[model samples]
Target: MVEAMAKAKLWTSPGGKRPDATLYAAILSDMRKGKGARFKKPAPGRFMGA
Candidate 1:
């Protein structure tokens, strides 16, 4: 995730392409594969700050 975030800084969206969409697709894939997206749900009234 850190690597992707770093790479994002160097990415440029040409022709109105959405780079974030691609990143999200990869995240969903990882979630489906039981990888990085196994985070527990945040408690009520407790925000998960970025």
Candidate 2:
């Protein structure tokens, strides 16, 4: 997913991590997952936000 997802300066800013795969491995790396996840994907191709 790292090589797949586009890397941008915003991800690097504020001392962010490298590669997008890492985030996915950690239940979205502290973003979204399932069952008590921080986010909810109600609609297709849309994030409800944090």
User: Which runs in model 2 stand beyond 4 Å of their true positions?
Assistant: 1-33
Model 2 lDDT tens row, 1-50: 33333354323223357434444444354454446666555666444445
What residue runs in model 1 are displaced by over 4 Å at the alpha carbon?
A: 1-4, 7-16, 35-50
Model 1 pairs in collision: none
The clash number for model 1 is 0
Error (Å) of candidate 2 at residue 36 is 2.7
Tens-place lDDT per residue, model 1, 1-50, is 43456567833333236666664454455456543453322564332222
lDDT of 1: 0.46
| Per-residue error (Å), model 1, residue 7 | 5.1
Worst 10 residues of 2 by lDDT: 6-15
- Residue 45, candidate 1: alpha-carbon lDDT: 30
The count of backbone overlaps in candidate 2 is 1
